[model samples]
Target chain A: MPQITYIEASGQSTTVNVPEGWSLMQGATANGVEGILGECGGSCACATCHCYVDEPWLAKLSAPTEGELEMLENTASERKANSRLACQIKATAALDGMVVHLPESQE
Target chain B: MPMFRFDPYSPLVDADPFPAYKTLRDEHPCFWSEEAGMWILSRYHDIVAAGNDWQTYSSARGNLMTELPGRAGATLGTTDPPRHDRLRGLIQQAFMKRNIESMGDNIRDIARQAAAELKGRKQIEFISDFSSKFTVRVLFAVLGLPMGDEQTVRDKAVLMVQSDPKTRAKGPEHIAAYNWMQDYAAKVIAERRANPTGDMISQFSLAEIDGDKLDEREVLLTTTTLIMAGIESLGGFMSMFALNMVDFTDARRQCVANPALLADAMEESLRYNTSAQRFRRSLQRDVELHGQTMKAGDFVCLAYGAGNRDERQFADPDKYDITRKPRGHLGFGGGVHACLGMAIARLAVRVAFDEFHQVMPEYLRVQEKLDWMPSSTFRSPLKLELSIK
Candidate 1:
């Protein structure tokens, strides 16, 4: 299991062990993380799982697909260089101790 | 105890199918319905798994149990992935939550206007007066369709979902409505192509992905399917939400007192009684579940309504608790083919309820016996007489 830290917009931080093959969105949602709604159940269709990857961990994660990019454009929060949909980032041992910042709103 | 039997088309089941759904989930999780000639999966986990595995339970053949002619491989709901993905990606831009949220004020205005129309009336038919009219108007406004023919379009949309129990297939009127909608959609697509606008139809006409655009037939089918679905399914869900409020007065009161609770209440209403009851998926490969093996080419019905009520998934699944935030509920279906208009549906319904509650905070169902739409795929009240005063 890879431990991921989710820092909310309110500055509250929660860490959870995300099982292998589970997306960051699934881990956050399943563990009751407040900011990530994961409204579409890990599907890239809904942009409700918007999150900002911490600077260091941004380089390790896979690049966003065209679909993810399209959905990112609709995120309620501001999109940044490190912004990503948590559903698109799969949890793996290589990405242990990754930190993702939750957006202010996921609407 | 009598042997459990389930029929999606039975008027009795149509009236109240929860008990039958419970029975299916418990004794026969993967029961085959002889009447409808389809295998039914009732458990929540089973439905979610089936919906996710599009390769096994395919939607390419046809998604509707009472599928209309020439609709199997035509539109978003009927196509498989790669193609389905492309179609969805192209069409999704217009339905994103951000875009829909901008329409909140307009939706609220429409809802307030509709509520105001019944200001002097003590008794009102909810479906006709409020739900259907509200949804149709919202959809037409969003799509840039003309309003004068709303009643005709609504009638055709309603008829499009109905199946003849005796014949076990689409009725004559259903076919007629399908043809009418097809022609209407073609004309609309042509007009939109000729004169592009900011509406959804125009967006579909102009939407492109890497130089690949929706062909005329694809646009036509998508338009036709959306009009019917946008009208009936969305309207039916609104009616169901109203029915839930009427039945669950306590929950309704809580929502009325605190507008914030309305969003959760809407979700609870969906989980408790979704308008979309059953949709079919063709088995692309042999799959075994609970001692029954569904062979390839066989049609399997994914009972979303039944799955939502599965006790294994939710505690006291039958109870309509406003606080229960059922995030992954099958209210919008699941997987890649989840309801595209979910954002719009949520926005419209929430705004509509908020506006309606402002005017009429409370209402009562005038009749105990309710008449539901005769459709296998969708479930909703055809008429709900309510006393506003």
Candidate 2:
């Protein structure tokens, strides 16, 4: 299990052991973590499940697809270069302590 | 020049399009249709790219093949972001998964009552008796419209997209239906304004994006667009799923035995027989694809039906496998302009099948001939009269 840390915009941080292969959005949503709305049920269609990866852990993740990047631009919250759709991020052993910052709004 | 002569509205394709779709995908990935005057994209990758690349393929002109042009900056579906994003985001929460999930009981009850009505009837048209009832009742609940108005709304909504050859030729009649939708939506908006309530209509009336609220016209168009986009397709999809059960008994039995696989069954049905076969998009800029130059303003039909059945994407794409993984399917489309009411649709479908199977677990297909309604965009059985076992 990969231990993932979800930090809310409000500075609240919660750590959960996410099973490998589960999306970050699924993990955060499964544990009732606030600020991640997988409105499309983990489909990359909706950018509601966007999360900002902590800079330190960014190196371990792959680049977002052109579609995902376009979706990031339309997210309710302002997009940073570190921004990513949580559904696109799969939990792996290499990212055990990966930290993700949830946006304040997922509209 | 089109690699192969194909008319989407032709009787053969209208009756069953998979054969045509397969041909289009294999022969001409980006075929130009002289009859329709649009470039047809059939491959999964092409459809996905076209949908995502808003800069290259704009939706501002509208997505309907029969729609009158010059609709830029109009409804959510017909516009590009940041306008599309703002419009969608404003009401997105209203149709969110949590909210739609909350309506599960309402949907289930509607499905149950509709299903129960079939108990004594030896023969029943699934579309009229059951699917329409479930779809319309749920729409009423979601839109905050009066329940008594379900039939009127359903009738008009159906008329708006009534695209059979006869109906297609009746331009004035289609326009009349379109006008009725706008007028009805305007009335609903006025009523919501006079008396605010906790419904999607009221929410749209009160919603603000950047402190700017939707005007009467905008609200009316939005409401009408939502109804136009939602009603028929949802009902059509339900009918398609029911027909699938009759066509695939073993798959149906598997679903009946393990209700959990209902979701997967629905996905397989969606992929196998996508209701919204194709949607149109106008090229934003001149683009070359497969050695053809498609100029800006040229309409392009993103063939979701073909893409869904693309052999490269799904293993044995023609085979309808309920247990197959359902992810990455473009049944509801993709990218920013994806179906807004997807959550609501999914919930309604799951609940509809769950309640329906409980009441009528088994059914038989009486006839081999199904009257598939002719439409350039949508595919539906005109009437699936079933005799319950």
Candidate 3:
């Protein structure tokens, strides 16, 4: 199991075992993480499932797509250099110990 | 009441049914038929009267259509005042005219994009490819949701609206759509809370008037209501309207010649072949309408389409004349609980017509057509094949 540490909106951190091929958004939402809202069901239409990648994982994951970037611009949270739509970041075996910070709100 | 067995989606329903509408208007101000099983008000005067008399005709009894068991009543269209007033107020503030107008460029831009994808196609289905694509784009813009998973959400939502006997039983698609939308709303609420902005959802979450706000059910219901209303009305609307333009080239040419004529086209279409068919309401008190006593708890159908065609109100009612200066048409409804999102829906549909006229004049030359799913209380054309060939 690839371990992923999700830093929730309230600054609480928990490590969950994310099987490869599952998107980070699905992993966090299914685990009842409470903050990541995949409103568009990983379609990238909604920027609700937004997060900032930890240092090591930023270089490991693929770059954000144009659609995701456009959606991110509408997020209530501040856009960061590492801002990534969680739906776009697929979990892979190489991403063990990966961490991402949840945005302040999904409302 | 004169019974011609007419419903808009019925195959026998002609393009012009003014004679029947006249008979209905003359014979039945508030007539009850055992066959239809509900009292229907078919005259323009009675229709407007019913809408204005919300005190007697409460929406809380539910709209003209029966829900799929667990659910009852409409979110905005079927509810009466007081609570309805508050809900509409909140919704109007969020879905203000300025916001809908701001989306005009985005609406036209989307139509342009869809036109690009459809540039070379010939003899194509207009509804799925053109109308829905264009309609949903504007819908999402108005919804303030992102544009991905558009098809999935639409498909799921459609299933959720079905009320067939099979659907009344445990149905996977119907259940999934409802669950998905609820989940979607919750997710949107969370995101908006985390990152507040000027968007409608953010506005809804933060909005307060006299320190009052919506409860959780009100929030969820309102959000889903807006989404479904836009989705159902627009997709079905453009399909039928496209077919009409295809069949009536003169009207098409007129609209093409004058962008302003499209507004008339929109109104005439709503009058002629309504996308929104009927909204039902139950009587709150024993009321006397047209000399017939309708007791409290009786549901009545306010037939907007029928009233629009009533000869006494509209001269040459069934001629499909866009220049009729349509007035008192219940298409967007009337009185207090009228659609708060009327501006948005009208703008989206008209933009579709205007943009299509500008980009592709031959848009009406359709190839084949598809049927929208049927409902007891509504009529929506599902697909229209456009002939780009």
Candidate 4:
């Protein structure tokens, strides 16, 4: 089991055993994390599963494709260096101590 | 409210049946559907009560006809209270009033373009040519999606609301669509990352709740929700609007004569002929609504469309008077989970009515009967052919 830590907007911490092979979006969704709406499901089209990855864990992940780079421009939250779609990021052993912040709104 | 056998799929799909609605509104406050097998609240007050009362009618059971795509346990729609609050808060911050308003000019521009595409055609398949295409374009533009693969996306969305059991059983398409959209959105997000633009995606990428950063899933899901919500809702509104306007030439001309009253027309059209039918809620415990004792976890439906026609709520409720004040119509939904994209929906319709009437005045309706979207969740024309003679 891969240990995944979720930090809420209010600074509360929840560590869950996220199974490998599933995307981070699936992990959060399976655990009933409220912040992720995933309205379009795991499809990167919705961007409801947006997350700001911990800078340290960025290198191990797959670089975003051209299509994804364009969709991120539509999110309500501000664009930043570490911004990544959670659905695109598969939960892997390489990223065990990763932390994510919540956005203000997605509706 | 009752098991009214109205095949919205066949011909006469555009006919206005206010009398039928009034009867249901007066008599059946709450009735059990034998076919749908769910408790439906049709009266206007009852519909409002269900929507307003979150504890009694919960969204945690999910909103889509079946399990939401890629959703395993409880997603945003199926949860209540703190859980819903957390998700709603994030979404609200991104879809603020000012942000949606700022996009009004853009939405109008899209509506004009949609109408433009239908120029000179004698007959047009309203759903495929106009409503689906136009709404898809506008929504993806809002999401900053490239215009390359829009038709495919629209097709996928249409597939979602279909009822035919075999088609409904095909889950792979939806799952495939989810993955494709996630990929598309991710790529779009990356562009803003490299060279940050003024789009919402750029803003979300940089947003911070409490000094921490949003992970990948949050961004993707938010984008997905916006795209899906924007897609169905806009298309649904447009189809219903066209169905009403074409059928009632007088009401159409009234709006054309007074463009400023486009909003009034939209409000009336929605109240009189709402597309979203059941605001489905799952029961939390043993609760008695009207008379029936609803079992815990049973699906309790709030029939907004029926509610709008309820005679108890409005005098002459069966009449489609554009000028009448449609107070408390449950069209855009209610409470915390109320349609947050209403700002955009209103703007879209207001602009659509303004432009539609300007270009295609007195367009003739095609004889082909319209097909209603099959899913129990929503009630919009799947296809409506219109002839501009």
Candidate 5:
């Protein structure tokens, strides 16, 4: 299990152990993290699970696919250089100490 | 010992299928339905697994058990991925939550107008007078279609999904409605292509990706699919929710008192009695479940209504609880081929109820014997006469 920290827009932070092969969005939503809605149930169809990756861990994760990039354009929150859909980022041993910032609203 | 019977098309199952679903889930999770000539997956986990594995259970063949002629592989619901992904990507932009939320005021206005019409009525036919009218108007507004022809379009859309129980196939009227909608959609696509107005149809007509765009046939099929789903499926859901409210007075009272709970109530209604009862997927490979082997090329029906009420998934699956927060329920189906207009449907229903409850806070079913729509795929009260004072 890889532990990931989810920091909400209001500065409240919660850490949960995400099982291998589970997406960060799944971990946050399954563990009752308030920030990520995961409305599309981990499908890249809806960009409700928007998040800002911590700067250092950005490069370590896999790059967003074309489908995810297209969906990102529709995110309700502002897109930044490190912005990503948590559903696209699967949990792994490499991302054990990763931190992701939640957007103000997922809509 | 006699084998348990489960026929989706049977009037008995149509009236109340939950008990039969319970039997299927408990005794035969992957039972074969002899009447429909298809495999039925009734358990929650099994349906979800099958939906998620599109490669094993493909939609390219057809999504509907009684699929319309010339429908498979043409529209979003019928197509499998890569192509499905491409079509969805191009079409979903218009249905994004942010985009749909922007139409909130317009939706609310339509709802208000519809609710206002029943101000002095002692009794009202909910499906015809309110739910159908409201959904059709909202869908027309979204598509930028002219309003006067709603009655005609709504009738055709309703008939399009229906099948003849005796024949166990689509009736002539169904095919006629399908053809009419095809011609109607083609006209709309051409008109939108010639004069783009930035509406959903226009967006579909002009949406491009990497120098590729939807062709005329694709645009026509997509438009027709939306119109049919927008009117029949979405309107059916609204009627189902209304029926739930009427049946569950306590839950309804809670929703009325705290308007904020309306969204959750709507979701619970979706889980409790989803209008989308069943959808079919063709098997790409042989699969064994519960000692039954479903061979490749066999069609399997994913009973979403049954899956939502599975005790293994939700506690007290039969009870309608607004506070349950039944997330991940197959109310909107699941996997890559989930309902595309879900956000729109949610916003429309929430706003409609908010406006409706404001006008008629209390109502009851006037008819003791209710008639349900005769369709295997969709379920709703065909006519609901409600007494409103």
Candidate 6:
């Protein structure tokens, strides 16, 4: 299990262990963390689960797909270079202790 | 010349479009339909690309052929980002997945009563008796409408999306239906505003975006859109789910034996036979694809049904196997304008399946004659006769 840290916009942090193959959105949502909507049920069809990846782990993650990128542009929050839909990021052992920042609002 | 002559208006194609979709994906990935007056993209890659490329392929024109271009801010589905973002942001909280999940019990209860009423019947009309009734009940619950008026509201909702030849020619009838819906919504909005009932409609009345609440016209249009979008396709989907159950005995058996597999089976049915066959998108600029140049203002049909069955995306595309775990299917569509009522749709299907299986797990298709509702986009039987065995 890889421990994932979800930091809210107000700087509240909570850590949870997510099994491999489960998405970070699933991890945060299942653990009852606020700010990640996952409205499309992790289909990447809705960009409600937008989050900003910390600089240290940004390079390790694959580039956002064209669909995800287009959807990211529709996020309620401003899009940064490290912004990604948490549903598109699968948890892996190498990503243990990774930090993700949630936007203030997903709508 | 296009490899396949595809006429979406033809009854034959509406009855079973998978064959035509296969032809389009295999021979002409970017085939142009003269009858529809739009370019049809069938392959999964092309369909996904066109849906995501909001700049080149625009929905601001309208997603339906009956609609004219440039009515961008009128509806959530018709507009692009910035505007779409602001409008959706105001009401998105009401339709969130968690909130929909909380309504599962009520949905299941509606399904249970509808299914129970069919007891001791030799032949049951699935659409009117079960699917439509169940769907309208859920719609009423979600919309905070009076349950006693379900039948009349259901009829109006149907006519709002009616695209049959006779109905299409009768323009006033269509306008009358639209007015009835808007008028009904206006009454509901007024009542909710006068007295905060805490229903979804009331929530819509109170929801404020950037210190401004949705205006009267926006409220009515948004409410009417939700009702129209929720009823027809969902009713059709439930009918199709029942059809799939009888068509595939082994798959159905596996689902009934293990309740967990029911969700996967429902998803498989959606992929195998999607209710929404096609949606239109206009070109924002001149673009070339498959040796053809499509200029701005040109309309194209994104064939989601064909894209779901693309061989490049799914192995053994024609097979309906529940174990396949069909993910990333374009059943609910893709990109920004993806179906807003998807959570409601999924909840309706799940609860209906659960309640139906609990009461009558075994059923037989009694009617050999089947006729699909004639529409350019949607596909479902007008009536389905089933016998509980």
Order the candidate numbers by DockQ, best to worst: 1, 5, 2, 6, 4, 3
Give the candidates in order of lDDT, highest first.
5, 1, 2, 6, 3, 4
Angstrom error at residue B45, model 4? 1.7
> What local lDDT score does residue B255 receive in model 1, on the 0 to 100 scale?
86
Which candidate's lDDT is highest?
A: 5
* TM-score of chain B in each prediction: 0.98, 0.95, 0.88, 0.85, 0.98, 0.93
Give the Cα lDDT of each candidate.
0.86, 0.79, 0.68, 0.66, 0.87, 0.79
Q: Which stretches of model 4 miss by more than 4 angstroms? A: A1-107, B1-28, B72-76, B165-196, B202-206, B210-218
Q: Which model is ahead, 2 or 4, in terms of TM-score?
A: 2
Winner by DockQ: 1
Query: Could you give the CAPRI-style class of model 6?
Result: incorrect
Model 3 over residues B1-389: C-alpha lDDT tens digits? 54445343333232333454565677666777443456778886577657656787777766635443323444655556666655555656555444567788888788878867766665667767777777667777655677798887777666666544333232565567777887787887787788887777777766766666766766766667666766776676676677778778889889888878887787778778776666677888898877899888887878777887877667787798887756445666555555566666677778777777666776545434345565545566555666642
Model 5: clashing residue pairs?
Answer: none
For candidate 6, list the clashing residue pairs, or say none.
Answer: none
Candidate 5 deviant stretches above 4 angstroms: A1-35, A41-43, A51-62, A70-83, A89-107
Better of 1 and 5 by lDDT: 5
lDDT of 2 at B97: 62
Chain A alone, TM-score per model: 0.98, 0.96, 0.95, 0.90, 0.98, 0.97
Q: What TM-score does model 1 achieve against the real structure?
A: 0.90
True contacts kept of 5: 0.17
Given candidate 6, what's the lDDT at residue B60? 80
Query: What is the per-residue lDDT of model 4 for residues B21-91, given as tens digits with 9 covering 90 to 100?
Result: 45455555566654455676777656655654567677766665454555422344555765555544444
Worst 10 residues of 3 chain A by lDDT: A37-46
Instruction: List the candidate 3 regions with Cα displacement exceeding 4 Å.
Output: A1-107, B1-23, B33-36, B68-74, B165-176, B363-372
* Candidate 2 C-alpha lDDT tens digits along B190-285: 888889988888887799867766666667788887787667889888889999988899998888888888888988887888888888999878
> What DockQ would candidate 2 receive versus the native complex?
0.09
Supply DockQ values for each candidate: 0.35, 0.09, 0.01, 0.02, 0.30, 0.09
DockQ winner between 1 and 2, please give it. Answer: 1
Error of 4 at B189 (Å): 4.8
TM-scores for all candidates: the values are 0.90, 0.81, 0.71, 0.69, 0.90, 0.80
Query: What does candidate 5's lDDT look like per residue over B5-72, in tens digits?
Result: 88888777777899999999999999989999999999977887687678899998889879998788
